[model samples]
Target chain A: MTFSLARPSTIVEALRLLADDTEGPTAPLAGGTDLLLDLDDGRSTARRLVSLDKLPWKTLAWDGPRLNVGATLPLARLGSDATVRARLPGLSEGVDAVGSLALRHRATLGGNLGRAAPASDLLPILLAVDATVRLVGTAGRRELPVARFLRGSRQVDLAKDELIESVSIPEARLSTYVWQRVRPANDVSQVGVAVARSGSSASWRLALGGVLPVPTRIPEAEVHLTEERPRPEDVELAANAAATHARFVTDKRASEAYRRRLVATLVRRAVARAQIPPGER
Target chain B: MTSEVALTVNGAAPRRLAVPDSERLLDTLRWRLGLKGTKEGCRTGDCGACTVLVDGETTLSCLTLTHEVQDRAVTTVEGIAEDPEGRRVLAAFAAEDALQCGYCTPGFVVSLTGIRKELGASAPDSAVIEALQGNLCRCTGYLAIVRAVARIGNGNP
Candidate 1:
């Protein structure tokens, strides 16, 4: 029943608010789609929630090389932006599928990544697009690759006095890709496989939620697909390795065995769909 | 612990008050604003029964803090008909028999209005369905709801 709310109008002010508060569990609130749920359910340890909507941190801009998405940019804007939809179709599609339109309209890409949920729709795409997170703290701004930014499920590398400012996605023509998954009857994702292929480098970005602790990527599975048609046997081997790498767990929604089975099937389907020419659709 | 939370509610400025830090926007709307049209079916974001529009974006009022929405514009189902597009959406919902139990209707109406306003003529059927995935309607099926919005927006039966 006790919580401190801090609203800052500028990024520097927000950073200072985070840096100065050394007293309790702290979390930055963007849209509150995820963090508020955790708090209400007693799953979060946040006692001091720093509201970021007051700051000038919701702008979306392109600096000619990278797309600088403010930490507070809602998921709706990310998905609806024409430039994003055309340039990063995979990311746009992923954000579009995050929740109901209402949730997406309020959920922020930074908040989604900051939550680090294995089933987070945006994480795999971020990994596939080579996105980086910019964190501001007392020491100044530092950038970390999306892969390294997420520490684990529900955990991040953000210090007590730090906040993610924006995520910079390098401008890259997203080759054909597919993000297919199985969700519970309620549209909650069970297992997700995000695949992206460059001109010659076909990469499979695998991320599973509901049956694992956090979103995971299998480098071997991705690297193995760079060559000719991947045989089912090859995919099976890669799926097992990826599942093992993810430390697949048995959760109420899906068992580890079922998840493993899905890994193989989803990986194969994702790769096949990724090879489909963009204009064909 | 008292804070002055001010925002434009339904195109009108209401008397700002000092609310406790623990109050959420959903509770504030129901208890303070007395706008009972915004139902609180679930305190969590999983259910869209508590959906509202903040700064023209559909958001789960249950999850948003009242203080966080200060200086923003809030549009609830009650306030939706103030605009031409909103009137069309509401009329369509009524014409389609979209509500049975009616508890989730207001949220759906607000959400659909927001989507149609944003998508205009370019929004597809798949996009409409995806936009409404969060809203749960246990009654009247979804045909009427979908048909109402589609008919109003597209001018086709």
Candidate 2:
């Protein structure tokens, strides 16, 4: 089954095309890394594809205190950008771990978040950094926290007529991301953890992925670490607390017990790594 | 909904053809243009047998749509045969005996070409490994392929 593809040069035109249901179901195509695979597999029945490749949103900019990442900015740029590496080190690490170099050159941040895969490397990092997603439609523009934007596995809080405009991350310090994968290279993580600390070291955020229905943060663990500088015992207690909150399932990749164990270990390692001097890592 | 899209393949004159929007660049290259050098492996993006250069950057033709290549230059393995860097990559592959079945060689060669273009000079072993991670080799255990890329990176060929 082949579909007609429409290349919209502007966001308003794209939104209009998406909103016209009388023309049949229309799906937006970005990067086409995952969307093409779905089309080839007969998973998508849309009759029209709205291509976002030529839109003006494929850029990265700094707006005041926050970094504005255009929804169409390729993952390769996100991983290699100097400012992103310095300010959002965890996000850099997470984007670098996605797919391979070739795929990275073509994949976009919007596609990664739009797919909303539970094992997506970018989701946990975005959650840890407290990123916000900017969405636009005929209804005008609104922003949603990254955590709230993701509704469930393979689902996002996106209306059919709305398109993601950009993702903004506020600057922070001492951020670190770590993951343990079955393969050493070019593989998705079996378990992933991200940690970001403020200047005081007392305030920190934590998020985990691949072990829950959605990439999420454990409030109990975050509160435990926010009280003071984390000691080895505190790290251990936080790790266990995070493990208790994670609800893992047995899949071909790993067993439920193994994922639970990995959640604890990765959280500990990520926290420790965040404390290391930038020059050392 | 078929439309005429113009593209430059292998440095040839821009060719215009009518194609369906769902037609992948891989199919257009192989079926329409008869450029069979770009093999189809794991039609999904996992296997990089369909690797090509779009505007000098490594790209997977299988995942790329026909319209995306409009007015863009695409260099396949066939087109790079006479290129100096492409020749060095191919020569290294031969000297290092980097194949058994040879089904995945074109993709590796194209990927190496992109890596050489990016690095511009000798590459560390770690860099070479990272660049070829997308191209998979079911034969030769990838040792000879990695050596071939390293040889090219070291300027030995």
Candidate 3:
């Protein structure tokens, strides 16, 4: 029979429980959306659970250059946070698009980041904003870039005994982008794209979820598209570069050919949208 | 092998119990609490059939832990008629004939209730879409359902 442990209050207390080696294969429980389901279905690799229910880490703050969002902050809070809505609206919009209202209220930023699903909405947005994840372990705390932290689908750079403390988004140039996708209602994603521009330098952070082994970033495509915008030759070159970099495997949800086509179409539109001002929308 | 969890279900005070770690919140609600109104169709979070309002937000009970909900408020389908705001959405669902099979109705109702409550007076069309994105309904194709719930805030159907 499986068992659960519920500890009340404080991040330090939660961290101690999470880092407890004596607990024996313990997994930290945040929203319990993904982890609990896995456990119910007998698919869980977890032996013990350290609940973060009362952890005092639910806050969203802006400190000029960086926006410090507690890992426990839920999607609803992220979507509605005035600072997020004003500064990093892309990240806010991404969080708003995740799951349903109920899930959003319960699903935490840490859980989503920890789960590290390529289909994770906030991740693609975080990549655009260049956010960093703060992970707390028994020894101390450390930071990892969002782009690098996500090692693969449902995987992260988190050590076995570490817990994600929070995610910080450093302020960037005032830029606009678009998140365009075609998916069944509440379904993960067929093709999701996030692109941005900084100074004269434009960048595209294209994430293909439910399409590849992990959220793959096509810098080659991004370079081609940003350097030579709208030129037919450049567009084709960029699209091909994206397809070359995108290692799409056929999933039950979608095909590699369909995803490739989406990448081409979405990359073009994302670039065009980024060129427009925010007020235009 | 077992642990006790305390929770507030549908406006009542917290009720405490001990169960095996493997038991889901949905199972505990039905088998233990006897609140049979919250139905379970898909054991996974994919289907909205097992939806409930946890801390006034809609979530899949089947995918939630009984222990995690300690001291949290859970609004189930049975409680919809009792809540003044929730009743409005429920009434809208009823007046529009928004349900066919009715199996997915409770989850839809709870989800809509959460949407109606969260968005309040200024919920834009996009906000409404985002709020209800997680729910899946085969009966209405969600048009009538959306139309029914959309009328609540703007007071225009």
Candidate 4:
């Protein structure tokens, strides 16, 4: 219930503050949507909360076909971007799937990645799009694929003094995300499926969210969906494989059997939705 | 754990106060600033009862730390009707009778006002609906709320 806030105006100062905060556990505060809740519920013991407000990370830029999303950019700014919608529909879809407009106004993609919640609406889509996390620390700067960065539920590969700088997404792809949830507004998804095909290579990437432990990419399923224009039966095989690929568990959000079923159904639906016409591709 | 802070509330001049770092914006508004219009429903972020505007954007005050919004402008339901869009939203809600228990009305009003400002006057109905997805009405069946949204989306606001 008690904590000290340190808002550093520069990256160096921020890093030093985080590194020097030997007071209990320390947490880097982004939007505070998830972290504050954790702190309130005794889920976090972070006595020193470092705010990233003054850092120049609230950027969203396009380089050729790639997109670089600044870590502090609000989800609302990202979701409402016409370029993001036109180029990366699945990413936009996932952004829209989070809590609400008000929450999204304060929720940042970096916060979502930093928290790494088991059912984060952004993870599956980030994996499907081959997004890489960019981090900076006293040690220096480095990048990691989102898959490698995720360790487990509420766990990430972030170091104590390191801060997420931005997320680098490869070329935009033909992609979409679908999910099943009790309430469309504020509830967590029971199962989320992301389907994507690279615009240049035409290869496929399949990822599932709301799974046990952590969300993961289904390479076995992606291999089945190799063709740019897959046959109907191939899509079916990929969907079935995706359902079989994950290790589902019966949790408070959904039953194991129900989640697997949802993975299959939503994957199939998302694949169809993400499919591009031969002329367009 | 506490520090002196300054902020603008409802178009007022910047005021300074010392507040605890653990205090949420909702707590600061209701308990410190004596602005109880922003009700606390879930205390969690799930409910929209603590909705307020931070620098013209809708934010969940219950989840927002008071220090997080230091030096920013916060507009609660109490000050919403002063804006032109807020005036229209309030009028539409009144015309549509968009209240039952009225506990959620302030949040709904503040949030809708924020959405309208963000989306502009000609935002589509779907956008309006989607923007309000976080708000909940435990009183009425939401038919009246839907009507109020329709009225606002149609140029009545």
Instruction: Tell me how each candidate scores on DockQ against the true complex.
Output: 0.66, 0.75, 0.61, 0.85
lDDT of 3 by residue, A1-281 (tens): 37556564876677666666574677888877777777766767677787776776787888866889888877778877766555665666577567666777778888988887756666766776667899887778999888899887787898766788889986543433343345645666666666644343454444444445566567787666555245777767776777667877666656788777777776666666655544454
Q: Model 1's lDDT to the true fold?
A: 0.74
TM-score of candidate 1 relative to the true fold: 0.91
Cα RMSD, each candidate: 2.7, 1.8, 3.0, 2.0
Weakest ten-residue segment in model 1 chain A by summed lDDT = A176-185
Candidate 2 residue-wise lDDT, B81-154, digit = tens:
75788899889999999887999999999998887786566667677678788898877459888888778767
Q: How well does each candidate superpose onto the true structure, as a TM-score?
A: 0.91, 0.95, 0.89, 0.97
Candidates arranged by lDDT, highest first: 4, 2, 1, 3
Which 10-residue window in model 4 chain A sums to the lowest lDDT?
A272-281
- The CAPRI class of candidate 3 is medium
Ranking by DockQ: 4, 2, 1, 3
Q: Please tell me how candidate 2 rates in CAPRI terms.
A: medium
**Segments of candidate 4 deviating more than 4 angstroms:** A199-202, A276-281
Model 2: CA > 4 A from native: A199-202, A227-229, A277-279
Clashing pairs in 3: A102-B58
True lDDT of residue A211, candidate 2: 62
